[model samples]
Target: MAMNFFDQFDIPYILGTPLVIPALLFPVLMCLTTNRFLKNRHMTIQSWLLNKTTKQLLEPINTIGHKWASMFLTLFLMLILLNTLGLLPYTFTPTTQLSMNMAFAIPAWLMTILVGLRNQPTSSLGHLLPEGTPTPLIPMLVLIETVSLLIRPIALGVRLTANLTAGHLLMQLISTAVLTIMSSMTTTAMMALITLMLLTGLEMAVALIQAYVFVLLLTLYLQENI
Candidate 1:
């Protein structure tokens, strides 16, 4: 079969084979784990928060950290798994696509708004319009907030898709160059092979760092809205 950089994007999947299955499982797994953890200690949600560090940071969040963390970890795993899978021969990286990245990020952005609304029904919109602005500035503040809110998913999707796509493209270019050199000069091929090896290692690191960045930003967004 002919191989090319774009060919990896053609991965086929059944209805349930997409990343959403694991994405949904993430929260379920977290809930089960949290319940077991709590049951083992015989602690109520209130006592759990008063006792645990994760819960403590989530204190201002109306105890939503436990739930959000579950989702965050799920997203983290799905991204990490998808990124790492791309490293394997003949596998596709879902994260390299704008649709998939947006799928992951849009929910996170919406969750921030939902959490804000649930926690502060009266003042959630006020978050966009900070207190003590001049009457004339209300329109400007609303516009600014609207723009800022809209940017969250766009930024998240672009950052992740760009990083993963760039890394894979670089790897493909280096590998193709190595193969081309191997057909001509043995020494040059060896050098290209080493470079490719190093690039592979760096790609692995990028995979992890990108996942962490995605989760960290999601957490920060949650913190801000809650």
Candidate 2:
């Protein structure tokens, strides 16, 4: 039963092929791409919000980092949409998959590291060690720093996966309890149902927050590189 519950987290497949790609791209398709000067109010408002968010995120970043603003902004929108939409009934969340999250994390993290290495090799390498360090601790500190650096993408993937997975599991457990006790104990079932509703709302907030945190961290990584 527990394994089956967790099996929901697995990527959906159709005829033995993964169906996650289309589900992942669903939000992008929902975005309007008309070239007309005039647009609907919803799309216009969304565009304005997107502009504002991009400005806010890029403001603290360096001018060189501004070049990547569009990419990051798109990523933010993608993540927010995915996270929120996953809560809808019968929808699959690609972000729930570690492989999917790792795919996003590794390349972005790699890009920042590569950019840092290509543009500012000395300064980038300097990040691994601090100044005025004692000679005895140099090797140990460098080793620890290297390990920390290597763990970042893994951290990113795991953080996202763990949060979403926990929320989903909690929701499932509460829902199962509600269903099981619905016939025998009306009072207990009602209370569990109320808690489930509250948790559902909380999960929605977590969804939005996790998305923002993911993008924010990515931008910070970019800031370090640029």
Which candidate ranks first by lDDT, i.e. highest? 2
lDDT string, candidate 1, 88-147, tens digits: 785667678888789888988898889878887667777788889999999999999989
Clashes of 2: 0
199: Cα error in model 2, Å: 1.2
Candidate 2 worst ten-residue window by lDDT: 27-36
Q: Rate the local accuracy (lDDT) of all candidates.
A: 0.74, 0.86
Clashing pairs in 1: none
Give all TM-scores, in the order shown.
Answer: 0.73, 0.93
Clash pairs, candidate 2, are: none
Please report the TM-score between candidate 1 and the true structure: 0.73
Q: What is the lDDT of residue 164 in candidate 2?
A: 93
